[model samples]
Target: MAVFNPFLPSYQADPYPAYAALRAEDPVHFSAAIQAWVLTTHEDCERVLRDQETFSSSSDTASGQLATVLQQQRREFPLGEVPTVLNSDPPVHTRLRTLLNRAFTPRAIEGLRPHIEDIAASLLADAGRTGGRFDAVTGFAQPLPIIVIAELLGVPPEDRDQLKEWSTAIANTTNVLNTEDALAAARQATMELIAYMDEIVAQRRAAPGADIMTALVQAEEGGERLSHDELLAFSILLLLAGHETTTNLIGNGLLALTEHPEAAAGLRAEPDLLPSAVEEFLRYDSSVQGAVRFARETVEVRGRTIERGSTLLLLLGAANRDPAQFPEPDALDVARSPNRHLSFGRGVHFCLGAPLARLEGDVAFRALLDRFTELRVAEGGAERSGTLVLRGMGKLVLEV
Candidate 1:
């Protein structure tokens, strides 16, 4: 049977039909093209994520387009050498995650709330002056996250544009480009970012400051701490993951509101509903579409037995819409109560930046709604990012 390529232009234009079809007929069907089983049900997705012992996160076992991308670039960006917390399992993942958690503590992120508000207000002010018409994605959504992430990483304000370009290149290199070139670009970007971070680390080492980087350099648990390379890798991961995902969240949320005016109006009437509205946005159009896992042992999920070493691709986007877990699964209801969406993921690998992301989303949407009295899609249908794993609009034009 022909396999479904969700990244294709046709699917990007309207993926719900395909998702519904998969859920009904092939929730756990194997694809020869991708050489992996695609899980589309909510229960199965939760099982794969919760039972990490049975399902590994090794990219080698990640089949489909994502696997092809990794396979092509594995040599330069060998999955093993990189110390990203997202790819590890068990004790190692626990340790790395614990160390990183200190940087994003409640107090730490809360401290930046004032700064975040300032950024949002300034961005909106600029947008208002531009005659109440702008590319929401470029003018507002993209810049807010990038600026906040740059500030958090101790990146000098002068070099933020360079950081943004490098980060965008790294994200883009994941799709279409040859693995070698993509890997080279990633490595080059990593090196440049690390060189810049090295200066911050060195300065912090000399004179401790209030930044997370400074705190991390001095942090130690039982005399065990991050090595130089580990620090560099973790820092880069924070910079990329922190902004990129939230940027999409804001863009996708704005686009969704514009497309569904009723839902947008409901939010405008009751600003208190912003939290649930954000959840609906995550469920309706998740930022990260799916995640990869390797079957550590033979496991039966949703009536299918997955063989040891076989790869499993859990479609979070599909799971969010599964009727078993959600009532009125296809509707965009701003007052969606009991909205337990998996946009930030689940289990031990749950997004450390969730709090910050939520805060940003809440502040951003409220600001956008208050500033613009009349908001509608201005130009072009939403263009999704080419990457298969990360689901988001590439651009969304809005007029107010």
Candidate 2:
């Protein structure tokens, strides 16, 4: 009998080997600790994502104790009645996604490129002002997304720090509910976040601005628009989804570059490779590593039967390194084309902030490489974010 416990120090430092073994030996094994069936291979993961009918994103499909847990989550938090885009299924998911697409249009994201560059450049300049040594997490990666999302939502500049605080507290609560302190903090954050967004919604109504938040407030489809609670939930979701994950992406990408000098130098020498490099970073160390879905009904998969209401942990990190999907899958190849990793996941639930995240990564990496010739991990090593669902560092101190 084999198992994958992400809590193990060895796995936290590097889960690739364990993931490889699982892909080869136990593609569809059960982890007793999580009490869920784990899917490791690229094929199985993709199959589960594509066939949402059998595996629903909505927890309403769950039964028994799983349903109890879902109820407990809502009881503990103030997320309102409507589901955010992340944990929903069609036609609820379909409607929310349709409206979301209008708000996160390609044209809007493309326009942010220049602004992203400016933000990245300014941060790098501040870091390099008194020579090159800064906490990448606090100095650059974290604030970039916070500032970007705040501006996009028409949030005042004075409130970015508070927004970051609430977003971080909420992100910490994902896939973790056993602890009293964590859940309490999450509930507090949720209440505050909702209240804060509620104020923004009111302000927008009074005098709409030229920003995405205003657009979402006024967006109508067949005379359909978000209600009071839906508007607040959407704003909170957009802030958390856009802010926390991309910060991790930037931090993780920089950490990868620090560890792999040759690849970093290559990226600097050939800046054209930044886009491909971003994908490789995502594959190598995804920000959101895995997601949970409830089994709509009992279904046999890869010779095992998953019962209804059973939790399914789709290992996006493991699937990205499945040898069947890539040559030398463990190796970080910035130039690896045809790279289709499930970091942001697949299907209708794919990350809406993917383009914005990629743009931020491209800008951040190029600016870092161009500004500093030498880059290495600083003292105290790196802290692994202790969450089952999201894989990222707490802080990445760098010497340049």
lDDT by residue for model 2 (183-296), tens? 778789889888878888899999999888888888878878877887888888888878878888888888888888999889878899999999999998888778778899
Task: Summarize candidate 1's per-residue lDDT along 1-400 as a digit string, tens digits.
Answer: 3356754687666577777788898899786645778888888888778887888776665546556655555456523266567777888888887777767788888788788888998988867455656777777888898888887767778888888877876776545434666667776876677788778777877988778887777767667787777777777777778878898899888888887988878888899999999889989988877787888888887778888877777878889999999999999998999998888878998888898898899889988998888777766635666466676777776766
Task: For model 2, name the residue pairs that clash.
Answer: none
lDDT of 2 at 63: 52
lDDT of each: 0.78, 0.82
RMSD of 2: 1.8
Candidate with the greatest TM-score versus the true structure = 2
Model 1, 357: alpha-carbon shift in Å?
Answer: 0.7
Clashes of each: 0, 0
Q: Against the hidden true structure, what lDDT does model 1 obtain?
A: 0.78
Alpha carbon deviation, residue 341, candidate 1 (Å): 1.1
Q: Candidate 2 regions off by >4 Å?
A: 63-68, 128-132, 175-178
